[model samples]
Target: MNQMALDKAAVLAEALPYIRQFSGKTVVIKYGGAAMAAADLKAAVMQDIALMKYVGMHPVVVHGGGPEVSSMARQMGIEPRFVDGLRVTDAETMAIAQMVLVGKTNREIVTHLCAQGVKAVGLSGQDAGLIRAVPHRHRSARTGEEVDLGFVGDVAAVDTAVLETLTTAGYVPVIAPIGLGPEGQPYNINADTVAGAIAAALKAEKLVLLTDVEGVRADRDDPGSLLSRVTVQEIREWMADGRLEGGMIPKLQCCITALEAGVNRVHIIDGRVPHSLLLEIFTHEGVGTMVVK
Candidate 1:
C-alpha cells in the first residue's frame, strides 16, 4: 500500500478502541461562535456528529445563536445591550433570541444532520419543559445590588426523559438554549450552561464545548502554554489566583459543574479546525483541553 493508504489505515486503527469504548455512550456537544457561522465548518461538524452516530455513539447538540440574534436586533432598529458581557434582555430581545435560536440556528443544524443521513430532531428548552429555569440574577455594577436580567434565566433543572427517548431511538437531539419558566414564560439561557446541565442530568460520558480559541492557555495569549489536562480543584485555584479570568471563568465553571455532577470528562476544543470534533475525540493527541474531576 502507498503511504497515503497506510496513513488512512493507521488513523482508522487508532480510532477503533475509542469507537468501541464510546459506542452506546452519550456525548453532549455545545456549538456556537465562529464554527456555527462558517458554512464549510458547520457542514464538517455535522459530518463528524453523523459519523459518531453511525459508529453507535449517541450525540446531542446544544447551540447558541447570539450573533444571529444581534444581527436581527440591529435590523429591527433595537440596539442590543449588554451588562457585564451578558445580554441585557428585555421582552423583545428575548423574543428575538428564541426566534433565532429555535427557528433559524436549530433548524439549520437539524437540516445539516439529516442531509448526512442522520436522524436529527430540532428542539428548544421549552419543548416538553425540557429546561426549567428561573430568572438569572446579576449584581448591578454601579450599585452593587442584585438585579434581574429581563428574560434571562439560570437553568433550574432539565427533563432528560425526552432526550433519552430521542437518543434511544437513534436520533440526535439538536437543542436550542431557550428555557421555559414555571408559568410558561420564555427565558434565554447561555448555551454552555445549558449543555452542562443536560450532560449532568443525563450523566453523559462526555461534554464537548466547541470554542473559538485553542483550549485553555496558561498565559491566555501564548498558545504554547495550553494545558491539555486539569482537575476541577486546579481550576478553582487558578480562578482564585486570577490566571483564569474574564470570559474563561464562565467556561471553566461550566466544566467544573459538569465534572461535579458526574460527567466523566469535559473538553473545550477549538471549533475553527475542520473535523475538530473527531480530532478531539478519536486521536491520542487531542486538540484541546480536557477537564476532569
Candidate 2:
C-alpha cells in the first residue's frame, strides 16, 4: 500500500484495542465551552458522540448554557450575577435559565446528534427526578462569610435508572442542569456538578469535561505547560498553593468527586480542538489531562 494508506491503517490499528476495551462501557461527557458555542464545532462533537454510540460505547452528555443564559438575561434587561464562580439565580433568572438550558440548548444539541443519525433524547435534571437538589451556600471569597446563591442547587441525589434505561435502549441522553428543590422550585445547578453526580450515580467508566482551555498546566501563565497526566494530590496541591483559582477550582473538585465515587478516570480536555474527543479516546496521545487517583 502507499504511504497515505499505510498511515490510515496504522491509525485504525491503534484504535482497535481501545475500541475493544471500551465497548459497552459508559462515558459521561460534560459538553461546554467553545465546542458548544460554534456551529461547525458543535456539529463535529455531535458526530463524535454519535460515532461513539455506533462503535458500541455508550455515551451520555450533560451540557451547560451559561453564555446563552447570560445573553437571554441581557435581552430581558437583567444583569447576570455571580458569587464565587457560581451564578446567582433569582426566581426570574431561574426561569430564564430553565428556558435557555432546556428549551434552547438541549434541543440544539439533540438536533445536531439527530442530524448525525443517532437517537438523541433531550432531558433535564427535573425529568424522572433524575437530579434531586437542595439550596447551596458558598463562603464569600473576600469576607469569609456564607452567602446564599439564590436558586442555585447542590445535588442531593441522582436517579440512575433513567440513564440506564436510555442507554439500554440505545439512546444518547443529553441532559440540562436544572434540578428541583425541596419546595418543588426549579433550581439552576452547575453543569459540572450535575455531570459528576450522574457519573458517580452510574459508576461510569469515564467522566470527560470539554472546556475552553487546554488541560491542566504546570504554570498557569504558560500555554505550553499543559500536563497530560495529573494526580488528585497534584490538583489539591495546586489549590493549596493558590495556583488553581476561580473557575478551575470547581472543575478540579468535580474531578476529585468523580474519582472518589469509583469512576475509572476523569479527563479535562480542550473542546476548541476539532475532533478532540476521538483523539483523546482512540489515540495514545490524549489531547487532555487525565486525572487519576
Candidate 3:
C-alpha cells in the first residue's frame, strides 16, 4: 500500500475506539486558560467540539471568562479581587462578569462553532434556570470566620434539561458560568465547578478541561513529570504528601468530583497545542492526565 493508504488506515484505526466509546454519549468540556485568549487555539478548540458532535457525541461546553472579565473590569476601573481562589464578586463585579461572559466570550464561542458547521447556542446559567446557586461560605484566611462574598456562589444544582434539548436538536450548548441564587441575585460561579456539576447531572462520558499545562505533574516545576493516569485514591495520597497544592488543588478536586459522580473519565489537557483534544481522545498516546474513579 502507498503512504496515503497507510495514513488513511491509521487514522481510521485510531478513531475507531473513541467512536465506539463516545457515540451517543455526552461529554462536558470546561474551556478556559490560554485557549480562550489565543485565536488559533480558540479555532482549534471549536473544531474539536464540532468534530465530536459530527461523530455522534453530545458535547456541552462550559466556559470561563475570568481573564477576560478581569481585563474588562480593569478598563472600567474595577479592581479584580479574589478570596480562597474564588473571585470576589460584588454587584458591580457581577454586572461586568455577565457582560464579559454572556455578551462577549459566549458569543465568540458560538460563532466559532457555527463557522465550523456546528450549530451552537450561547446561554448563561440564569437562562432557563439551568444552574442554581447559594452564597458560598467563605472562610477568613486568618480568623476562619464565614465571610460573605457578595454574589459569589457555589453550584447548588444543575438542570440538564436545556442542555439535553439542545444536544437532541443537533445543537451545541455553550454555557456561561453565572447562576441565579435563591434571593434572585445573579452569582458568579467557578467554571470548573459548573462543568463538574453539569457533567454529573448529565452522567457525561467525559469531562475535559483545557488549560495551559500539559497535565497534572508530580513536580509543579518539572514539565516532563506529567502523570498520564490518576485515580481518586492516588489523588488523595498526592494531596496528603503535599504534592498537589495551589491552583492544581482545585482542578484536581473538580476532576475527582466529576469522576465520582458517574463521569467515565476526566481529562486535563494543554489547550495551547493545536488539535490537542483530538490527540488526547483519539490516539493511544494521550496528551493529558486522565482521572478515573
Candidate 4:
C-alpha cells in the first residue's frame, strides 16, 4: 500500500474502537475555557462534534459563558463579583448572564455546528423546563458559612425528554445553563454542575469537559505529571493531601459527582489543542485525564 493508504488505514484504526464504544450511546460535553474564546479552537471543536455525530455517536453540548458575561457586564459598568468561585448574580448580572450565555454563546455554537454540516439546536434550561433548580447557597471557603446568592442556582433536576427528543430527531442539542427556579424565576447555574446533572439524567456513556489545561496533574507546575487515569478514591486521597486545590478542586468534584451518579467515565481535556476531543476520545494514547467509576 502507498503511504497515503497507510495513513488512511491508521486513522480508521484509531477511530474504530471509539466508534464501536460510543455508537448509539449518549455523550455530554461541557465546553468552556479557551475553546470558547479562541476562534480556531472553537471551529475545531465544532468539527470534532460534527464528526462524532457522523460516526453515529450522540453528543449534547452544554456550554458556559462566564468570562463573556463578565466582560459584557464590565462594559456596561456592572462590576462582576464572585462568592466562593460562584458568580454573585444581582438582577442586572442575571440579565447579562442570560443574554450572553443563552442568547449569544448558544447561538454561536449552534451556527458553527450547522456550518460543519451538523444539525444543531440551541436551548436554555428554561426551554421546556428542561432543568429545574433552587437557589444555591454559597459556602465560605474559610469558615464554611452558607450564604444565599439570590438567583444563582444548582441544578435540582433535569427533564431529559427534550434532549432525547432532539437527539432522536438528528439534531445536536446545544444547551445553556440558565434554569428556572422552583418559584418560576430564572436562575443562573454553574455550567459544569449543569452538565453533570444532564449526564446523570441521561445516564450518558461519557461526560467530557474541555478546559484550559491538559487534564489533572499530580503537580500543578509540571505538565508531565498528568494522571492519565484516576478513580474516585484516588481523587479523594489527592484532595486530602492538599494536592488538588483552587480552581481544579471544583472541577474534580464535579467529575466525582458525575461518576457517583452513574456516568461511566469523565474526561478532562485541553480545549486549546485542535481536535482535542477526538484525540482524547478516539486515540489509544488519550490527550487528557480520564476518571472512571
Per-residue lDDT of candidate 2, residues 1-293 (tens digit): 99999999999999999899999999999999999989888877988898899999999999998999999999999999998788999989999999999999999899989988999999999999999999987889889999988899989999988999999999999999999888789989889989988888889999999999988899989999999999999999888878987777878888999999999999999999998999989899888899999
Pairs in clash, predicted candidate 3? none
Q: How many residue pairs clash in each candidate?
A: 0, 0, 0, 0
Report lDDT per candidate.
Answer: 0.91, 0.92, 0.89, 0.90
Q: Which of the predicted structures, 1 or 3, would earn the higher lDDT when compared with the native?
A: 1
RMSD of 4: 1.5
Expressed as tens digits, the lDDT of each residue in 85-131 for candidate 3 is 67788889899999999999999999999999999999999999899
Model 3 has a clash total of: 0
Candidate 1: which pairs clash?
Answer: none
* Candidate 4 clash pair list: none
Segments of candidate 2 deviating more than 4 angstroms = none
Candidate 3 matches the true fold with a TM-score of 0.95
Which of candidates 3 and 4 is the stronger one according to TM-score?
Answer: 4
Candidate 1 residue lDDT tens string, 37-71: 89989988999999999999999999988999999
Best by TM-score: 2
What's the TM-score of every candidate structure? 0.97, 0.98, 0.95, 0.95
Off by over 4 Å in 4: none
Candidate 1 lDDT trough over 10 residues, lowest sum: 241-250
> Candidate 3: where are CA atoms >4 Å away?
1-5, 140-145, 240-242
